[model samples]
Target chain A: MDVSDILAAHEAKQKAIVVEKDIPLEVDAGFLTVTDLNPIDVESYNEDLEDYLLNTARDGVQTLIASLFQLPVTPSEDGPVAKLPAPTTLLPRAKPLPKPKPLTKWEQFAKTKGISHSKKDKKVWDEEKQDWVDRWGWKGANKATEVQWLTEVPKNADVDFDPSAQARKARKERMAKNEKQYQQNLARAQQAAGSASSSTPNATSNVQRKRELDKTLATTRISTASMGKFDKKLDGEKKLRGVKRKFEPAEVSSSTEKSHNLAILSKLDREPSAKKAKSGGDDVLNVRKAVRFASKGKGSAALARQSGGGKGKKGKR
Target chain B: MSTFRAFILTTTVILAMLRTIKPKNARSKRALEAREPKEVEDPRTVIFVKGTHAGEKVDHAMKELMALKRPHAISFSKKNTVRPFEDATSLEFWSQKNDASMFVLGQSTKKRPDGMTFVRMYDSRVLDMCEVGVEGWKSMQEFKTAKATPGHKPLLHFASDLFDTHPRLQQLKSLLLDFFNGEIIDSICLKGIEYVISITAGPLPDSPSTSSELPKVHIRAYTTRFLSSGTRVPRVELTPMGPSIDLTLRRHQDPDPELLKQALRRPKLKKQDIEKGLGNKKKMRNLEVDEMGDLRGRVHLAKQDLGKLQTRKMKGLKTSRDDADESDESDEDEGQVRRKRRKV
Candidate 1:
């Protein structure tokens, strides 16, 4: 029996099941996606763009479906079911990236002063109990001194000076201080948000973005030779808002500004000398220290030259 | 509490006064609606505030930090002469207005230099705050490397036993988690993970030290890169994405009991969410997800009698008295073997 015709048909069916390409289509089974990295065939693309795109899409889908079938399936009541892996494709998010939050009042100061936030534990190690205990709350370490068995009374204690009561009062004051601060923080946050929302909405919009882009184009236009003086103007083009250079009024003289600059210079000169004098010596009695502030601009050596040992002896005495 | 619980009456809460506000305008209505309790809460809004005095370093640190919080963060460019410790009215007012629940306050002074405070807000109220001093800082500019995309959820790595056991470090860990946790999401693409914020404890005390001192905190930010490693999972490499900071913990405030309780409250969990193993239950009946994203369900049945089972009628099935008895015996034996295999 000549079954060669049947064998050829079988081979064709098998070949169709297996995708063969110069650069095999990259199939991400996780995302059920196939990417064709191979360069486009210019001959086919130029001939018929739509037909080429359709074929390309079909091939991608075919590859993806083939990969999906390759996944291991389990028998179920309905039939066999294949499980998919986690997606690998990165999809664009719907919302814009979140903006960094504003600095809190405390954070601003900390940043400027170079303070790192330190976490405080809720519990503290108690040396007396030889164990860890709550810093505050029921049976906390803060109330330890109040519960001490032995209490010593100071010789100058008031008649009604209750040591435990005094300690409790101080602790209560600290709690009051914290409560006050918490209330204040809440108030500030509300106010900040209220004022912020008013302006934030206007900051970004289609109209504003278009206007900004137009402004950039206008600047680039005027940046050419002759500063756009000889450039051809386009119809319906808005007037350019270029920066206007300002010159000092002809009426005003440089003398007024000159004095201001001179004053600044003099202040700068005096500040260093004053600072030097303040930090001149380790002690107040040092002659160099006294000369800077106490004396009328006289050095210790100069004072000695004027009064010899008399001035020095008087200072000693 | 001691025998003398002075001012205890002042701290007591009156739950009766909790008011329900009906916003008047469409804008306000939307704002209030967004703040409504949800099974999945929105990414917390953070407001950056400057104090009476802020230095160049503070500005740079904020800029680097802000780079990570864009779109969800608001920065007050104008310097305000507000002191949080002395007065917190401004913070509360801002929280209510902006709907911001987190804050980074930067302030520098002669007494407390280079101070930063992280304030957590609950229902427009300060839940807790922790202050730290920046001993050393390195902004993103110094690294000259690519940074993580702003607003991407950060992979927070707290490499310290203190975070789990110590109370103070635990607070910082949770605070940082909320600060960097951009949005609430269930399933995420493994490749979507971008940057990591690593915090390692500086030094360990060989012996217990005085209660006054705390070990310094080192915060390092990195952009993660996945390189092919000839395996299903790729090898991860960390590139320094800066604003690396060294910090020493200072003054901290613990949330009041009533306030902390409200902060920890979560919306009711749905049955489907619980079935996904979000709750304490380790196993659930029937419906479950098997390998990858496939969902599977078990359909149970009692033992079946194979001899009486319906089969396609064929000429061979019409057993004349010849092999009917033999075929019946074979079928029974097969059924018994099947049931035994199922039991095993």
Candidate 2:
């Protein structure tokens, strides 16, 4: 080999032997390597040996002298400490561990959906949880804080946390939102009303006229079957209205006959006639009187006519 | 001697008249007719089964009622002459059988004109209308902060003394309240072996203005409470017991399986379909009847055959087939195996 190549190889050997002084890396392998090699502080030993010595020179001579006084070396009771071999210049370098990924803005926003980002800057209240949360980024600003929104709701900020009151606040906010929407709708309706009033003068009157004309047109198309029935009904009604509203003379005559019979019965109970008693001896008289009374609607005139041709039957006494 | 005899006779007549006028009118006659046919709501009925009209004991009446056959209805000439006092067994039986919602039985020393001691029963609801006793405890607020401190000992002591005065009576009242679902109860009245209890099941509270809502009931419970002192306590006022009804009750409150199933059926379905369903149920009942008829036929035949076969050992003739078959059926039903089957 050339002199320059030999010099480069020796420099590489010197660099490999040097180690950083921090928590140990590659602890699984049988080695004890340390940086800032103050030879007095750290001791390196072969793995096969039972005994080991710690280098106390780098820590200062006070530590060395204290150790030389031979203070009792009490090993740890947990597990045996193994002796590690000294690091050589030819040892390979240890690999580094992989780094963790960073969170995106969407993920950060999701976490704050139902929680307060910070307690110090309490502005907008988390309506769902009824607690204060960050307003964060609103109103054309980047990263507006909870402290700003908090000024908007002073009454809420001042009150202590009460579950029932919080629920009321949420309800009030919801109602306010609805009322705002309703007011907007009312304004729109009022605008429309103003525009319509200015534009149209007789829109409703025209609509009414159209409806009346349509009704007249509909009435002209009646079914023939229904029209015939309607005509017959009207004729029957007129006849009913024209009829005479009085009782018949036949009915009056029957009532008079009933009254006359009642009067005769009353007279029979009061006084018996001598002529009638004498007539009782005849069988023909009984049969003839029975036939006269038994006839339907038997009136005195009809009986009189049947007995003696509309004249008095008996001779005058 | 005539004057002395006359004086004695006059004295005797006056004594007899006084005895006849003894406080019989005070005892009211029990209306038995009111309790029958249609179930009465707490008709105070005093049933006097047996025992002498004079000096009739409540125990004797209770015994007679217990011994009387099931469904024995008797009418007495002296309706208010005999009475039963606090008879639990008869009270329970009458409550169950007669559907008497409330009952109270007590002995009254008041005798009738005929010198007969009588017992009286009253409608328990009368207590709700009329004040009975005093208030026991008012509200829980008094005991809310009653920690076991030196000052609290005196209050506890007072309570202990009150409990000690009537331990058994209080226990009995507690037991009765438990027996009848925990009703907002009033005092327990004991008028000569008569115990009248009044209970008002308080209304449940109204629910919030949420979609899932509950009913609201008016709390008009006029309840009285008795003190530890046996004497009637006073100063306990109450609200009106109100009408004994729930107006805003849901119709068909519970879905009766049979009724609900019938209601769910097609409205277009004819009455004949319903009749068919009922007829099927009746036919199932008739199948059991047929089985019984077969058993009776077998029993009759066995009895006839047994009589004919028994010749030498027919002196006693006690092995009746009717009795044997009945006993066999009973034993089999009771899970007792039969040894052998007699062919007869």
Candidate 3:
């Protein structure tokens, strides 16, 4: 069989089989004619259309615009349209500007004239003046160059005048003068040394003799009052008499008095005792005896009056 | 015979003793035999002369001079006899008569409120004539009753303005310092008195003919006693006088400029060489670090390439095993499994 006839038979058989099966049919088929489909009610359709336009149509348009522009859109409460955000991604963040550098005088002039500033050259040394010179700019080459001729050249005056011969002559004269002075000083020093050496021994001997004389005189010296011959002999006699008197008896009884009178006679025969008395060696007994003999009667009356009058007057009262 | 002999001996002894005895005058003559003469010392005298028109300034000056305790300071008060700044001959004669080596003459007039005091040393050699500005003079008189200690030195103060304004004052101050042997003090305790002396010079009044003559010297002296706890009232008075000789000799002589330059010049500083050594050290250190880092980087890169090659060989072996397994399965089945895996 041809392919079309075979396919038609298979379709027929499949349809028969489907008819034989109890497959339920749809309760309502889709509309077959234009009239069977209800005509759109103009009034109700118009009302729904108006409601959508009022509620959500504007928001949909805003969303469409936002999406097209790649903007983040959010719906606002009071209005149907969404708000448009600022395009932050489109513009970069602002940064602070850098500070401008201060301009120097030369730099300011150069800037006004639209010229770049150039560096100055290093200073050069001037040989004649022995100093560094700034050779550029408005100061215009140090004045050292103009005064080069005035600098002294340090000429050799010795070669021109031959001063070595004159110097040598003056030095020889000074040497001769110095030699004469040295000789004189040497002679003077030698003479002084000789004189000093000679005088030293004489002075030493004189001092030694003086010391010996002083020692000898110190032992042999006596009192100035007894330097006379007679006074010396009398002093010796008085000393002898003092020695003799010590051996006599302590009590001056008549027996001892007779012996003392004999001793005095012996002293008077040998030498005078008056010289001893004048030399501050008077006897106390003799002095008392002399005083008593001179004022005996007069002293008794005065003594009696002085002692009895005051006592007798007090007794009478 | 024995009694007769004793009487004769006693009479002879008495006669001899009386003859040998010397008088008191003869004894005194012996004492005068060996006596040395005593030395005599010359007296130092400073005389104070009160001149014409001198009111109380001379009295105040005398008090200060006494306070100084100078060796022999004598005050001569012949009010109408000697005039202030009179001829030098009279002063010379007066000084010679008084045996005074130094003289201080004081005078004050209506023209100068501050009194004048002239100090002359070595006869007529006038040292200075200065003003003594006296304030509270009456109060100082009250303090005269109070006694100072035996050797207490009075404090001396020179006002700073006196030194700055008057050149002659500096000269006078130096002279005073020398005269006092630097014993003048700058300050003192409240128990003692403080004397502030200022000296100045002005034009001479009557003698306008001799412009070369020394200027009229004026001295202002102030005296005050400080209580332990109270404000002090100082007595101030000004004195003016003229000197016989020139005062220019008191100025300090200037030194030679060339000698000063030689003395004050300083030596130049030498340059240092350590900076070059330090720079070389830094350069050597940097070179060492660079060489070390380059060597380390070469080794690290070689190891990384070796590791990458090993991983690539391992991946190649895995891909070959997968190719063998894929060759065993049907293309359609493998495709469907891959699709299922992708869907899962």
Scored by TM-score, the top model is: 1
Predicted chain B of candidate 3, TM-score versus the true chain B: 0.36
Query: Candidate 1 — what's its lDDT?
Result: 0.66
Give per-model TM-scores: 0.43, 0.12, 0.22
Give Cα-based local distance difference scores for all models. 0.66, 0.31, 0.40
lDDT tens per residue, model 1, A1-317: 99998888766655554556676765545433345555455576558743554455444444555565556666566545556553333321212233345676788799999999999999999887799999889999889878887788899999998999888899999999888877877788776776567666645654687889887877787677556666778898766665444466766568988887899998865645555657656543556556765445766665656566454334531
| Global lDDT of model 3 | 0.40
Kindly report the TM-score of the first chain in candidate 3: 0.14
DockQ scores of the candidates: 0.01, 0.00, 0.00
**Better model by lDDT: candidate 1 vs candidate 3:** 1
Instruction: List the candidate 3 regions with Cα displacement exceeding 4 Å.
Output: A1-317, B1-45, B56-71, B83-86, B108-114, B131-139, B143-147, B161-165, B175-344
Could you tell me how far off, in angstroms, the CA of residue B96 lies in candidate 1 after the best superposition?
A: 0.2
Candidate 2 ranges with C-alpha deviation above 4 Å: A1-317, B1-79, B82-101, B106-182, B185-344
Expressed as tens digits, the lDDT of each residue in A22-47 for candidate 3 is 22211110100000011223354346
What docking tier does model 1 reach? incorrect
